[model samples]
Target: RDLNALGGLAKLMPFTAIFTLIAALSIAGTPPFNGFMSKWMIYQSTFLSGNGLLVFFGVMALFISAATLASFIKFYTTAFGGEPTKLTQNVKEVSSSMLIAKGFLASLCLLLGLIPALILPLLLSPGKALANVDLSGLITT
Candidate 1:
């Protein structure tokens, strides 16, 4: 849908707005979301590498992350906040199936963030085997 059409639709479609908000927050790397976990690991690894250039890039990454956060905040607020426009006057919540799918993915984002250890083995196994490195020790500490 066009950007103008989304104005005020959040009230008509609250659930979808909520889902979008969660996804946006996750993408922005807010804490307790999957994106934050991966970004945190990246920053940690970059800093630990002790390379001057990599450290500079890591700082750049932090600035980029902040920019992303601001952009998403503006997007969510503009699309979902304020009074309903003519185009959004009749908007309604989406079907249950769509909501179920979105809810499932959003919950996964939370689960992955809160307990990454559960999925680390599945994620690291192939890399571990290919590189002949012991990632178990790395993941635990």
Candidate 2:
């Protein structure tokens, strides 16, 4: 929580830093990432409804996404950039098993981002099951 106490960890724990970077960027809703796609789908549905109130909320969601990006940028640059502070100077990378786990999760994130169609049907299953909505049109490349 105290970012002021952290610095230059990327040099000490390069692998961990990379994984954290992926997590940060994905959550920040950067393009071609799952986070962005999820938001896009919600915003698309909201705007398509042509309701002013939902449109306003959708715009607010975009602003929130920007704020998320800014916050994560601060998080990455402060924790991974600059000279190491006393607290982070002796930090070490995690075990190989942990790295493997992180790598698997990171790959999944990238996959979902790059190929949303792969999961869109699975994700929309409940909606289809309940309402039998024709959601095939909502699927985007």
User: Which ten contiguous residues of candidate 1 have the minimum total lDDT?
Assistant: 132-141
Residues 1-141 of candidate 2 have per-residue lDDT tens digits of: 798899999999898898888889899888777887888887897777789999988899889999999999999999999999999878888999999999888887788999898888888989989998868687555
lDDT of 2: 0.87
Specify the highest-lDDT model's number: 2
Tell me the lDDT of candidate 1: 0.84
Question: 31-78, model 1: which lDDT tens digit per residue?
Answer: 898888778877876776789999888888888999999999989988
Clashing pairs in 2: none
